[model samples]
Target: MAQQYTKKMIRQVFVQMLNKRPLNKITVKDIAEACEINRNTFYYYYTDVYVLLSEIFQTELQIVIDKYNETLSWEESFIVAAKFAVDNKTAVYHVYNSMQRETLVNYIYNVAGNVMIRFVENVSEGIPASEEDRKLIASFYQCALTEMVLRWIAAGMKEDPDTVIRRIGQLFAGNIEASLRHSAALHDS
Candidate 1:
């Protein structure tokens, strides 16, 4: 519990600091001071600000995953994700305007990959999906999805998530399974 508290404190400090300045300008010392810990303690928790940002991304991804994995369609899941982005727009924009773009993109890649993987697994249950093929398809889908999201964020995240979700669902309707098959066929070709 104490450890959890410490981690939470660290995360809180990170959010507070990010709200105030660019990520590159915020040092481990700044985080440590804000969290009332020494640099060593900060190092014990995270190697650097990038790692800290990664942790935050994973935590947020897991929250969305854990909450709606079984209950939501892929479109719904994406809507939830967009909502998460919108809800945290301030923090996200702050991070976006920081030096953590690479870290942030990696985090989104993992999150989007996980979502695509799960969606494929559920929809393709009992269908034979080679691990390589699954990964490739997931990678493709994740890349596209992340690009869309990055654009959405860059545009100030102004569109309504439900509308965005519905449009994406319509655009990709039936293509999810078809795309997987097409990708598998291409791989096997």
Candidate 2:
């Protein structure tokens, strides 16, 4: 009888392969061999390996977001989210170098959005900024965070992630509150 493998096992094998080789060089047959699953089983679930890659990013990043949903600190949330890429440098580069790089970007965007919204809410407790404005602020920071992570990936991630995250926190310190206060004052006037 063939052994049954869960998607988590399949995903780990796929990511391990990604760490070792570029996405373009990875084949379903190779995945099957690495996974020790029948090619038929692989085919049954995905028409293309990229489909599985996309699914892995979406599922994994969503887990990160859900896990940090209660966190009060956006910077801490970003560090945790960014750690995935930092830890999986080769795999991340493989995905970033592929045609399906948008999947990676979307994952970062989702995490950034999640953290930023929570951050804005935490800081805007007594502020009079409309929910719309608060959301706008979160969106702004989300884009910034996404770009920061993308740039780090593009630059080969030579910088220590904690240092980078800490510097960002230092640079942006009080900026969110200032932005919210400005929005409220503008709204009042």
Candidate 3:
């Protein structure tokens, strides 16, 4: 129990510090001082700051995945998945502007990929779309979603998520089923 609390405190402090400055500017000493623990304690909990950052990414990814894995509403799932970036803009931007931008991009892609895969599965529920076709459709939308999200992030995330989600939905609202049907037809032929 105490160990859990210490780890949580360290995460809180690190996120708070990250919110204020770039990831490169933050050190174990800063986290240790903020958490009221020593540098060694920080090391005892984490090997390095990147490891802590990786854990944070993994935790957030898992949360989003678990919460929306079976969720059929793609738009709703996407908006909620993007909540962390919109909420923690500062920390996200700091990382985005750092050499670790790949990590952030990969995280976004993974979230988008999961949402797209699940959404496609639900949408093609009754269709005779082959597994390969379903996955191809999912990959198509996932790439589109990932690119839009990365562009949004690069542009400082000034747009509302609802509007973005709506635009995407509108653009491809019936396309998934249409694609699935087309694929099924091709497969049948």
* Candidate achieving the largest lDDT: 3
lDDT of each: 0.77, 0.85, 0.87
Model 2, position 131: C-alpha lDDT score: 89
- Per-residue lDDT tens digits for candidate 2, residues 1-189, read 233455666778889999999999999999888878888988877778888998887777777777785544777787878777877899999899888799899988988888888889989999999889999999999999899888988998888988888888998799999999999999999
lDDT by residue for model 3 (115-136), tens = 8888888888889999999999
Against the correct fold, how does model 2 do in TM-score? 0.92
Summed over model 1, clashes come to: 0
Misplaced by over 4 Å in model 1 are 126-136, 180-189
lDDT of 1 at 68: 67
For TM-score, the strongest prediction is: 3
The window of 10 residues in a row where model 3 has the poorest summed lDDT is 64-73
Clashes of 2: 0
**lDDT of candidate 3 at residue 22, scale 0 to 100:** 99
Between prediction 1 and prediction 2, the one with superior TM-score is 2
Query: Residue 32 of model 1: what lDDT?
Result: 88
Give the TM-score of each candidate.
0.79, 0.92, 0.94
